[model samples]
Target: MSDNQPSPDTILRLINGYWSTGILGAAAAHDLFTHLEAGADSAAQLARRAQISERGAQTLLDGLVSVGLIDLAGGRYRNTAAASQYLVAGRPADLSALARLKLTHMGNLTALPEVVRAGGPVTDAAVEVADNPHWGQVVPAIAAQSVPAAAVAADVLQLERAGEISILDVGGGSGIYSATWLERNPAARATQLDWEPINAIARRLLAERGLADRFTCIDGDFHTTDFGTGTYDIALYSHIAHQEGPEDNIAVFTRLKDALKPGGALLVVDYVVDDDRAGPAFPLLFASEMLLKSKQGGTWRRADYHAWLTKAGFSDVSFHAAPPATLVIAR
Candidate 1:
């Protein structure tokens, strides 16, 4: 390469620097986009609204403007199109809560050094020390995101004719999957199995959705729990399989198959990696985060899921895309 040209690796690293996250988090914490939704404001105005020092607001706003998250005209800052659409509070596409969750709870990026030193999955020591209900507290937030996925999965699973149908939601935090399905199909009943603390959250969520009458929350570990045999018309294994290794995932699927009627369907929703394991940066990056936090959690390819489903005695295994992630349906 010529002296004037930057190396591809160097360019990539520069583009993906940690500063991006800091800037995004700062913008979210200040609610900068929300304030700018109506119109632009000067740094002093923004500082007053955000209750931060003028200098601090100016510095953060400058960075945001540089990153194209905000626009500056006549020394007043306004949200960029992308920020206005996705970062502003009260908007349909708002992802501010998700951003805040990442910044406050996950803390994966900040724990990288310790994770590397330990050569193992990083535990949330702060939460553990405080006896914090990490999974319980996050269940509501997870359920909010899962609502759409559940609806899509239910549609694809085709659980319409319901007559005392049994449905198992393995690792189904907050009972979103079962709640959604039960809400649509009144005659169907569901069993949501998850950690004890998370089961409390699931109960609360089901009650909130007026689904408590049709859904039962079971507090237990799926790995050790007996999911029963040939009882369910539909089994949903959404967003939990990737947190395990292939062997464990296959075992879970096999168990799910045994729990389902001969013609019943198993619905799985997760980030499915392409065969090459290249591009689609979000899923791959999520897999890395899983690696950093779990003993054997990572994203899997569609082919891998299909193969496992077939081996688990489910024929007609297939994959369907649900916007960001893929849904694997088998019967």
Candidate 2:
């Protein structure tokens, strides 16, 4: 192929991209980055440190080097700057859990052929509040990684300085948004409505932030929970809508509107595609992720959200671009 255009085989290369994913997963599983950080540079040294065979270590490290995940010079391997920052054990943005989460998605992705043929998701499993077995691991894992993004969202929301504003954090995991908002609006207080174990985590995080007295944690399912009418100044539905389909989202937004005071607003943060659904990449991949885990959920377009929010009786609905997702606010 000439430099002016890419080769058709590029699509085949992209389709078989699991080679890269597998390399990262195996490295994370064996604590390869951590070992490298601790001064194991040679393949034999890393192998002995990880208690694996030299040949296996050489193959893994070579692949990582080829992928730019690591650097090899003079027969010594080292984590690239990006890898050191995100893959190492102690780095603040350490995404080892996210890496493992991607590996978990492999099973669902492998079933895509069957899922499409059967005209339904192969697995309908999703995280739930009642009698949940995955929340203990899943909630914290997701919340820890996602809370920073929520902080970025808080900036975009630019919450008013009005004191005594009450917010209801729907499906709020660790109450990070509330904490962030409370930090900005000193007089504002929040009520977190989420599942049992996740609510417990929220309470702890709020207390740690010294905002426990300003916040309340309520453990219940979002669908069945009774949100007292006209009780809240604002309701934050961050990252929760993508788990529900068209009808469910419409119904939930209606409930949320009722839960709000007459002039109150509802804020929704979710992965949303444009009208054409062509791609911003993340939302598209997330659509597939939802298909793997959810029975009736996928990323929606902004137009979909606007239509549903309007049908739910919310006016002044608008969508704004946010990293990896879009923000919808309606009153």
Candidate 3:
């Protein structure tokens, strides 16, 4: 390759890089994209609007321009097309929450070396829900994502055919999955179970959506709580299983199976790795994040889920691909 051309390894590392994390965090915190949304402004004007030092704002603006996140013209700064569309607050595609999530976890990155040295034990001291107020915020955001994911899963499951469908949303914060199902299927009602603080948020969210009348909230630890018995037709364990180890996961699914009526469907939505555990960037990166953040953080394979479902007495196990992840459904 020519000297001017970037090496394949260098390009790969850049593609998978975390180098721009701080810049993204700074932009989010300063609301730079939001400021630019009104129209182009000088760095000094942006600094005043964002309430930051002018010199610092100029430096940041120039950096963003260098990265093609913004455009520079006549000593003024403006959001690039990409940033204007996706990073500006109130825009439909705004990813401010995602950016904030990165900022919140930035401190945890420092512990990764220590975690590797100690075989991942350092994550035991990683920020937990009790330690971080922002942790609760993730529940609602996750709910926004899960509700649709579950709906897709439900559609695939042919939930409308079932009579008197009862759904148990395990670790179902914000009750979005349950709420979505209830909205679509008037014959169906749901029970959302999650931690007390998160469940409180779920209750408020459900009420805001006028879904409190249709959904029930069970506030308790999923691992210890009795999730009721033989009442549910669809049991959903969305985006929670991979946080615990395989044995604990099996236990949870077994509990769900026991709680289900005969021939009931069990829906498991998560970032599933290939059985070979070799590739696909997001899940692998998520598994690494779990390693640095959760006690039992890693992506499980479809085979792993199938094995657990089979062991839990759930039959007709099937897997479906969703963007960024997969759904494992069993009955």
Candidate 4:
């Protein structure tokens, strides 16, 4: 076989992808990262702490090291910086729950062929449901991942200098954006629009962060819920676009634009594909998840967003790279 010819390596890696998720999920389920962070340095120690066999602990530790999530030295195991920061339980930005959530949702991906044939989620309320219990577990877990993006958005918009701004956070899961903005600017207040259950979660989280006074929530679907016109200085439509069809996105965006005060900014953050739809690997693959989870949803291209924002009555639009996601700003 020539070097130019195709290789089975990529295909094999794709076929074996679940092995990585399984290993990571098992570690998370066993709280291995938490144990390691708490000084379970050896396989024997980990087994005792995590209540697994020493052999099993050793194998799992080796697998974690192979996956670059753990480090081994002098026969002692420890979490890598990334794992320590994001996977260890009780860390400020802990994503252990998100790991578990992804593993739980893996079953949805297995039915991709059926979803493709049916053109949407074949299961009852797999993802696009308003009051689905999955949102309860999902919203909080995914919030940690948005911490960096939210902070960046706050900075990019100069919320600290803007002074006395009102924000509308549409589909504001966990209220991270509101929390971030309120923390940055003492005069900033926000209202999140989401389901009642989700709003309850956001309320509790914001209160826990001592932001309840500045962060309020309204329980309603963004599809039909009225976004009061000229009410907010900034409007945020984050992450929800991927689950919506093009028409729904346009309609909601129009509402968001109308909700913003004159000269106010509308920020949309999501997994946006390049216009050619060829690369930026994650967003392209994420479209598959939308297929499994939504009726008419997929990752969209820059051109699609530009057109939608223009049609939504925004006079200007700009895209910002936030890494692992993108932000589209319109005014």
**TM-score to native of every candidate shown:** 0.80, 0.82, 0.80, 0.93
> Candidate 1: TM-score?
0.80
Ten contiguous residues with the weakest lDDT in model 1: 124-133
User: Per-residue lDDT for 19-90 in model 3, tens only?
Assistant: 467677787888988988886388777888999998878777876876789887776678888787768876
Kindly report which residue stretches of model 4 are placed more than 4 angstroms away from their true locations once superposed: 1-7
Q: List, residue by residue over 30-136, the lDDT tens digit for candidate 4.
A: 99999998988998999999999999888888889988999889878889999988898887678888888788877667788988898877887645567688778
Positional deviation of residue 206's Cα in model 4 after best superposition, in angstroms: 0.6
Deviation of model 1 at 252, angstroms: 0.9
Q: Please give the distance, in angstroms, between residue 207's alpha carbon in candidate 1 and its true position after superposition.
A: 2.0
Question: Pick by TM-score: which candidate is best?
Answer: 4
Clashing residue pairs found in predicted model 3: none
What ordering of candidates by lDDT runs from best to worst? 4, 2, 1, 3
RMSD of each: 4.0, 3.4, 4.1, 2.0
lDDT of 1: 0.78
Q: Model 2 compared with the native: what TM-score?
A: 0.82
Highest lDDT: which candidate?
4
Report the lDDT tens digits of candidate 2 across residue range 203-239: 8878988989999988888888898899998898988
